[model samples]
Target: MTIGKRLFNYALIYKKTIIFALLMLMVAVAADLAGPFIAKRMIDQHILGIDSYPWYETDEGENAVLYQDTWYKREDHFSVDDVKGKEVRVLQVGRDYVFVDQPVTTPEGERTYEDGTLTITRSNEEMSYPAVELTNDELLSFYMPEVDDLFKLILVYFALLVVASIFTYGQKFFLETSANRIIKKMRNDVFTHIQKLPIKYFDSLPAGKIVSRITNDTETIKELFVTVLATFVTSIIYITGIYIALFLLDVKLALICLVLVPILVVWIKFYRKYASKYNHIIRSRLSDINAMINESIQGMTIIQAFRRKSETKEEFEEINKDYFDNQNKLLRLNSLTSHNLVGVLRNIAFVALIWYFGGQSLTANSAISLGVLYAFVDYLNRLFQPITGLVNQLANLEQALVSSERVFELLDKDGTEVCEDKMPRYKGNVTFDKVSFGYKEGETVLHDISFEAKEGDTIALVGHTGSGKSSVMNLLSRFYDTKEGKILIDGQDINTIPVQMLRQHMAIVLQDPFLFTGTIASNVSLNDPMITREQVEKALQDVGADRLLKNLQNGYDEKVIEKGSTLSTGQRQLISFARALAFDPAVLILDEATANVDTETEKIIQDGLEVLKKGRTTFIIAHRLSTIKNANQILVLDRGRIVEQGNHDDLMQMRGKYYQMYQLQQGKQSSLAG
Candidate 1:
């Protein structure tokens, strides 16, 4: 599946919260849109009052008022006694006007007509459908009610602002909560998938690169949910709201504003082209850098011992410089194309609106209202605000896309091993029948080989480095499947056995023992609940590692640092032996398990090995000729082929390759003693 579709599935899991937040976001946007519309209402209705005049007098020729160069037609007159010391109400009825005395303050006004001067006075009597005379104070009284309405509209605008603020915060809170939950599940899924991958997969990929996918890459993906998701969603809603408001205010301006759609689409397409390319390089380089750093840290001791620190530093610096240069390139691209360019477009849009409206306003009959102009500018500003935000996040969006792609790439690997439950256990009668294999195809590391060991036998393999001793162990343990022939245990092919079940009956102690950061007992038992404290203690005692822990304050509970760095090599090997013993597998393999120990430590380990090897089928791969002298069978390998196989004494009597190697080692010991 594509990353987009997979992310959509993850999003569906939290659809309830998302849908609620989106609704709240729309409400908030509506509240925001109300502000400019309210301002437009104030401009056109309350402040300007362009169509609100209603005080034309038409009763008498002398009493008629002239306003805006048009004289009022005389209609009727009323008595002064009827409205004395009271407010006058003027209401227009068809071509004439009606006067209702308001009984507060008497109002009268004077105006000069084209041919005559007229005086308007207030009346106490109610007159139906007639013009009346009124003073300047009466004209002021006509607008008095509008002042109260304007104040109320201002209060409403502020109330909407407050509402928008609250709903906006609510939507943000919901989105953030959902984003955090989604990414948490994603990280877990990635880590779980890593465990199922084949062992060969790890051989090809660096540990740090895998770590980057689970840790750093997943972290980068978080921004996609937290910021980018919210930003893009709100931007869409905000732009739509602005356009709706624009159309309501003035259809002409709104239709012209449609030009932004194609322009914005083109801009995004152009920017994403370069951004995706640069972002892919940046992400790839970052993974490489992380892999390098992890390798350097892990091998710091070897690097320092070999005096290759300068060379390592130089190599790392080259990678770091590449990462830095690509970042700058992306930066330059963002600076040139996105946010600032969006600002320029916004200004151009504003100029276009003003120029178009200014031309419309030049004609009297077709004048664009000031309210429509104010509201249009406000809506345009609001519409471009989200556009600017989206443009600013273009680089972040690209980075997130690249990071997600890398994460999913790891998840999409084909080498997931499924070890089923209820597979049969092995009886440890192992056999290799014409087996041949390679790390890579068609390059055989082990040729046609055959071997057999009975259930209770202890077989030994002696070989120089690169002589296929470890390859045999690797094949027998199913670390890699056989490319030719078959490996069998208890008369059945090992390939048919579930990997976990096969591994459950076998244990290996490597030359370099690895220890996790934990207490000594925890390391021995590996936190297995099935292995009780008694079993752990017994295992340690059986392997003779109890002596190493006896001096520590905590004994079995003594803390071990990462990779057991605080422990001596012999101490770590002893722990590894104890771990193998605690599991008590049916088959045991030791690949140079005691090679790193001193002579005294080796003797102790050798004695422990005797006790631990009881009743289990054991395979020993040793470089030291003295380690496997009493084996029931010894196989001497050379160049991926077994040149000699027999009991140790038989090989010695025959004076074969094993005998020559043993004699060489004896001579070295004698020379050292001399």
Candidate 2:
């Protein structure tokens, strides 16, 4: 799918909520801008320390008569010595100097200053005075505002903060909810695509590897949505507004600090490329390592019996070493992006600051206030922050692109089965006409194999291992289609039917029966939520597996471990038979159905086969010729073509390949008895 289309699909379900989240994010950006502006105003107006003193107006230019006071120093030299006899109290002393036990509060009124006296301050509530005597200038000129103005500024700043918090927190909650919803929908889409993917995909790709792409890779992309998109957008707005404010204050200072920004962007671009490369290498190798570990563990029994433990361990160590090496490369790239870039960018800004501040324009001509210089520095720091996310997000974006390519590639391909327009139902009849197949290109495992088995016919396909018996089954199931001919069900070619429909119409019992991990009822019913417990019990009875089920502690509720590992092979095979029967298919095929069974299971299989074969086309594939003696038609295959064909008595009278195999088995049994 196209990126825009996929994004629309992810958000279309909750479009209204997502729109609200986007609006909140914009508000958050605007609110974040206010914080620095508020701080700069606070410094310029409330903390304007030196500018609080009195000034007398001076006229210099023609038509100009106004000037503003910046600062004034006291001219008083009054000294206070503690009185020896008089009790300390708040009392006026002869209009010269006031004396008291505690420091005196200059009340809100005019106060005089001379060259050599210290003005000690106390509670302004103590007394009142003329506005001029309270400070070196009128009360309006001081850094601390009058009561009314303080309250006004407080109310405005508080409102700004409250709005900022609402935007910030509300944006976070809704963005996360929307992103999670998008991710959930994406995962479901991936799963649907995986189910529909051709069997060729499962044959070539590792299961855990696909799992990592679906789960881990998708989560990495989610990080971009959850944090990077939001932070980067807000930071950009903050940086732009700060840039504008700085330029208005002093253009030269703003220009000097901005010189390092482009350099940092170039630096980020350089490291992002290296990070993506390392990340890909790490991702691919992790898939390989996961495949190896899974296989080694699953084959542990074979490895131990064959004494290949050390070899397996060495193989794992090699892959493990490669995984860590690639991880280290990613770590180094991450470190470079965060720490090293900060140092270089900061150093360049510092050098530019020195040149700008030390220039003749700044020193002599321009009166750049310290507040403006400080704000410019803050803007300089903000400029490079989002550039860092852009760099790291490039790496994150790479993971998303790679995984998307894989996921969409699978989604784009149709299953091997041809799904034609039909009623999506079937009748019971199977016929293979001159079908030829192979495992790979230019390979013909089965050549010109024609077969006819009508409904209710028991056809036995006899062949040795690796002689295309399984390939025949695979072709009929459309796991791999035949190259030379077509397979028909009833009067219709199978290519005209959907895979699910075809599978629903047939059942397969392999040489090695596989079982899912679940309760006995679940295994029997194949976890079909629509299938009732009664159906499971009936299937178990049909396969003679109900006896074993009843012997278990929970009967139908008995749980099977992974792949039914807790059960014996014969018992597991019986469960597989029950599962196949539960589906109630019209075509039943069994390859070595009872070849590995004991005398007891052999008896059960004989009884179950009679019931299962009724009113169905049954194809039995076996290497043991004795098992097919009673078949309706037995075809003996050598290499990829049938060499002999007859009933049991007719084959024995002919003394052909089937006869020779039957004689050999009988001779071996007789020798062992003697």
Candidate 3:
């Protein structure tokens, strides 16, 4: 789906809240709109006293009159039954007729006059007289109650202002809350989806770039919901409402203001086109900068050791400069199209209004009244304020769209292969049937490979670097699918098993074991509720890791710093071995697990491995041949194919590649000893 449509879906989930917010916004807009109307009424009727408009006063009979496309109440004369204390508004006055606020009511079957004049006769009709015209001063005499009610008018106006403020605040609060909720969900969904992506996806992307998508991009989207969205909605309403008021006041002036609509549309269309493009570049560059920074921080020690700190710094400076340059481009665009440009448009509108009205007065010897002119200017200013606001929000809107596009791009990619819902547990019998694979397409690294490990057998893989030992391990775990042939667990296709279920029953102790920042017990059990404390203690004890734990201040509860940096290589390996034992996986893969430890530490790990491998099929990928000398079977791989396979003694008798590698390693050991 398009980013726009996807964003709409998020909004739809909170439709009720959004609807309520919009309604509140409208209520606030209505209250705000009332301000100019009230000002106009005070100026025209109270201050200028423009005309005398007649109104009816009667209590008993129904009265109705039609004037100027409106209907009002009219009576021939005042009656004793007339309501005693109600003040009537005089809406308009002319030589022939008058308009009023009172509603006109006619008897059901009476023949009524269409014009202002009306006559009625009855058995007990009261005294009556013809409708009379009143002067502005005479009308003011009837408007004495308004003068007395001035304080009440001011209070009501202020009350409406308060209502507007309250509703506006409510609208803001709800919109911000909704935005936060959406951003929270987006962050969670992105992070969860990241876990489900294929392993190869991570190989192609940096951790920081991925993190940027989850954190920075979603943060940018927040403005869409909170500020940009609110501004767009409220500004549209304000613009439309202002135009409506303008039309009601004077169609000619209103029509003149209509020119701005097309201009604004064109401006936005042109601006967004370039803005989105620049913003996309800006976001991508930012991701690059984040990736560089993350890599620099993580590998600071390596860079310093290699004496390449200056080169790394230079490379980072280049990336940072690229980001800064792109940002300046965006800044320039914003400078051109936003507030400053909007100010020019606003001033142009004011100049146009003045020019048009001034021309009318000069050419026709007539002009709109000062009060009407003032109200027009007020409404016009209100109309432009929102337009200016929209212009100012353009940059944020563009940034949001760019960020959303990147976020959705990640979400749209294909996830890992699907597996059966109910996968059976393997019984430690693994088989590879002429399997061929690669980390990427068209680059096969493992070809026509076949292997088998019966239950409880320890199979060893010995090979030079890039000879497909780790690749086989990865395929056995189904981290990558076979490009050709098949891998099976207990005679069932490994691909049929869910990755989670397969990995749950398989444990890997890597060459460099990783530990999270938590207690050793927590790391061993990974905080899994299924692994009891007793099981963790026993697992550590069985792996000879209890000695390392006892040395710490808190046995089994000692805090491990990031990546177990505070622990010795052997200690970390022992903890990892303990972790694998705690889970008691049906299959174990040790990838050079003791490669970095001392001979004494290796001996300790070797003893631990004897226990770890009990009743489980094990695959050992080792650089040190002596470590796997007693394996039940050894497979020596070369150029993506196993060239030698047999028991250690059987391979030694053959005097093949494995025999040569073992002799080479012995020479190195003898030389080091000398």
The candidate scoring highest on TM-score is 1
Question: Lowest lDDT 10-mer window, candidate 3?
Answer: 104-113
**Using TM-score as the measure, what is the rank order of every candidate, best first?**
1, 3, 2
lDDT agreement of model 3 with the native: 0.82
lDDT tens digits by residue: candidate 1, 579-642: 9999888889999998888998898899889987888889999878798988888888898888
lDDT of 3 at 556: 83
lDDT of each: 0.81, 0.67, 0.82
The candidate that achieves the highest lDDT relative to the unseen native structure: 3
Model 2 misplaced regions, further than 4 Å: 1-18, 46-147, 244-261, 357-365, 384-425, 672-674
From the highest lDDT down, the ranking of the candidates is 3, 1, 2
Where does model 3 exceed 4 Å of error? 50-144, 359-370, 417-424
What lDDT would candidate 1 get against the real structure? 0.81
Worst 10 residues of 2 by lDDT: 70-79
- Give all candidate RMSDs, comma-separated: 7.7, 10.3, 9.0
lDDT of 3 by residue, 1-674 (tens): 77889999998888888889999999999899888777777766555442323354433333333333333332223356655333233433223223333333321111222344333223334222233344555554444534644566677789999999999999989978888888899898888788789888899999899989998899999999989999999999889889988998889888988989999999999999988888998899889888998998989999999999999989989888988888888899889887777787788889889997887655423446656788889998898889988998999999999999999999888886544364445689988999999887699999899989999999999999999999999998877899999998888887877788788789999999999999999999999999999999999999999776687888889988899999999999999999999999899999999999999888889999999999999999988999898899899999899999999999999999999999999999999999
Error of 2 at 215 (Å): 2.8
Candidate 1 regions exceeding 4 Å error are 50-143, 147-152, 418-425
